[model samples]
Target: MSRIYRHPTQPTVELPPVDLLTLLFDSEHSLAQDDTILHQEAANPSNTVNKRQLRDLVERIAHGLRTNYGIGAQGPNKDVVTVISYGQMLVSAAFFGVIAAGGVYSAASPSSTVAEPARQVKIGNSRLLICGKEHQAVTTRAAEECGLPLSSVLLLESSPEWKLRSLEGGIDVVSSSRLSWQTITDRQALKDSLITILWSSGTTGLPKGVMLSHENLVAETYITALSGRQWAAKEIEKGNELPAVQYRTLGHLPISHIAGLFGYLLAPMYSGGSVVWMRKYNWEDMLKCLKQYEITAFYTVPSIFLRISKSPEVTDHFKHLVGASTGAAPMDGKLQMAANAKLGSGQDAMIGQTWGLSETTGAITMMPKGESDTTGSISPILPSVELRMVDDDFNDVESGQEGELLVRSPLVTNGYYNNPQATKDAFHDGWFCTGDIGSLRDGKFYIVDRKKELLKYKGLQVAPAEIENVLFTHPQIKEAAVVGVPAPDDPGTDWPRAYVVPVGPDAVSEDDVKAWVADRLAPYKQLRGGVMFVDGELPKNAIGKFLRRELRDRAKREMGIKAKL
Candidate 1:
């Protein structure tokens, strides 16, 4: 029997059938028109975009894309536009513009190599490529490699002036041309409409594109926002003076991921807040911006919080921060409490931990406002999200017993793009298998283990199979298995380590292997955990499958982590 768990406190609300773009700009839930929605962290007055201006820009870019590139000419969700760019205010424009033009927005990391973006382009069947000025060279190369025309590659610029022009000088986004987005109200259409594609490495294999729909985005945004509003209302009723939490956050993380996509782009618009765009992440600059912009709320990963807890540079910078949450990886309880102490100016500014994946469209569990849990739990099950902890046989585990966590929610992604088998494997009956082992106790959820082997480095997904495939390309490497070893300094993050069996003894050094990987893969996917050369064949099962658990346990033992694998 299925023992599905629902939020004990929060009531589930019926979600309205509406598209994401219309909900953000046209619907009753839209922000105030005159308010600033996007801000520059560099303190440039001209670099900001208000809600009114943003709407207009979205329309103009949409029109330009449709007119020049024929994006969305065949209808929505058919044309995929790939964007690989640094964090900037105009990136939001490109995102909405693509969606508004009826194109599926596909995000690729700016740190990605030529081959990575090329592969994504091929997989997505991308009609056009959009990138920032900084990544123009790589984007151009990827576009060429993928057989995409140079005219189809658009350069999104924000420094001297806001412009979206083609690298080959054929297309230009003009302010006069405006194309209104279709306001979708049909429930089935909303559920099926693919707006974005965020990549994720499931339990195994290379990165697959997680297809998110309008329904997924709308449900997630509404449910998350409703949770906060309810908590604020209760605080008001209790006659407790609530600290004003103006939803201003720094966009320092990669917008390619779901965390940055929802937190920076979608959430701020719904909350009538501003997102200060940081061109790229820099520790010192981030701290300075936090104090300078008086940032009130932000969502980040545990690695950043780890730095905040131990870094001497962190002082009153987080004073104005009233709301903060961490996700993408597990956070230590001690580090969470320590980081909380530096926030809210002696008020209740707890660093809540969220639990979810790109497949769930960001977070499935979020700690409500004015609440603090120091037990390392991922708060309660989010409203409208049903969770089930089950054993290997698909039978429900006993209450409070840890098992593989499966979720059923409107926020969950439809499936992986262009991959039917993967999509089928991702679900069990109607539930989306989370691949995370966790338990529900006293209405709070705690992640005990990961069923999946994907490595997270500073909130970015790094597939071990992708790294292993790169390693296999080397003639000197015979048999290679990649596993995530916990980073010594940074909590809640892992480094991709390779255990290799050489073709010949002493044929390749560790530095040679590391250098080889660094040249091929992205910076984050490099073997920062160091490569280990095995004497013979790796531990394997009777079927000749690699015993990743045993190697993972060995890796943990070497790292001084006493936790059982």
Candidate 2:
């Protein structure tokens, strides 16, 4: 039997039973009680980011959205602002700006293409698109393609490209009203709906927009703040209490990811803590920041941990770093042990694991601090979250049996934006199907495998089909199958491994193929894991569909690759 937790809201904290709703606010009474704790964080004197500043920023933005653009509460002022905040206060201000103006704020990964910005705008049915001027042209083109008038596009920063003279005198579309981002960040709440369109990583297929309301965001953030006190309590009880200590974190994950946006950004700030920024991932830079800032907590994916383990300087700076949390992708048990041992117990640093998706704002389950051997397990379900295991037929699965993970909670997204068919297929009754296969053991959750073939590189999802399709565009490639190979840097995360069958003898060099794909895809989606050649057609099951399991096994046999999982 799974462990039954003692918390008031979370009693039956069994596998698939504990969801965000059950963990955070299962009842009105629990919410009322927890609200006190949340308010305490809000009122903490040590808060690095003040609520008044936040409030002023929001009110200012609301006023700007209304006055500068003539967008009133009931007017047709539904513009969507897309941005990537690298753990900066700007993200919070932008979020508030959207809510204050009754507009939707869509998140875009900084790595996303200049052409894809329209996904969020079109999904939200937005009239205007706002972005930094460097990003404005791409946003403008994408919005234009989506049928959004270019007149509705607003650039936060001005560029020579934005000047109408660059495009042969007069511009075809009326320019959107210009206002300082500084000015727009001051308006207070206008009771406009709060919506943020989060794109799924598309491990399953094309990304869909997960719609979250203001109430959903506030509820999740408040609960996360309330529950975060448990961290301090766990730390002190583990015998590392200090009178003058402060909480700080290194935030490198994209603001577009739920784990980075909600868990690392909003939750920490809401708890009177501060976050350090790294625009992108760089192992040496991360170590330097840890040593320089004496960063207490770090949030990241498993691939980074692997790089750190391989680094010789990791041990020296490991002592200064406090708690570390890894999520978004699975980490190998051996790598987890290595990371844990690097940060000795005396330093009060705990290597924790958090499980989450785009739907739940981030973190459905957080490993208890000081616990040992959380290698493959995702710990217990969080305070108010709920989970369930369902068989292939949708019936409940028994404990210790692998099955699809279904989640139901107030924190789960209301549904996919404007896609009722997707919404219907994604949920059974009310449970959101995670499409991940896993099992429970001793009250903890462990992912056995994915029911679908999606690759995770340091927690970012990469669809094999997408890469294969991209590869097929090459003239020499006749057949292609992409599979994830356990990375040597870290056994925890998977690397995109491609197997290619060429049309002619020695038709393409590996470098040639890699260069071709690199030109078209982002850095993370590159075929850096190496490409292998095959003489015959790819092994397939009885059906015509490629059997990824067979490809993985055959690759392991042929390449002598072994997994630490």
Q: How far out, in Å, is residue 124 in model 1?
A: 1.0
Pairs of residues clashing in candidate 1: none
lDDT of 1: 0.82
* Candidate 2 C-alpha lDDT tens digits along 1-565: 3222222455332122222122223323132232221211111223333444444545566665665445435632255555533334345555655545656677776555655576766666665565554455676677768886655565442121211111222322222432222212111221123367787775445678777755455556655444445666776898977445456766566677777677554566555566655545455776777777677667666545544544457666756555677876555455566556666353333667777777776677776554545456776676556688878788777778767888876567777777999989989877888887767777668765556776778787666755765675566776677888877787667788888888778999899888988897888888867888888667542112355677787778755734533
Candidate 2: global Cα-lDDT? 0.59
**Stretches of candidate 1 exceeding 4 Å from the true structure:** 41-46, 201-204, 235-242, 346-349, 453-565
Error of 2 at 175 (Å): 18
What Cα-based lDDT does every candidate model obtain? Answer: 0.82, 0.59
Displacement of the residue 188 alpha carbon in candidate 1, Å? 0.8
TM-score of each: 0.80, 0.66
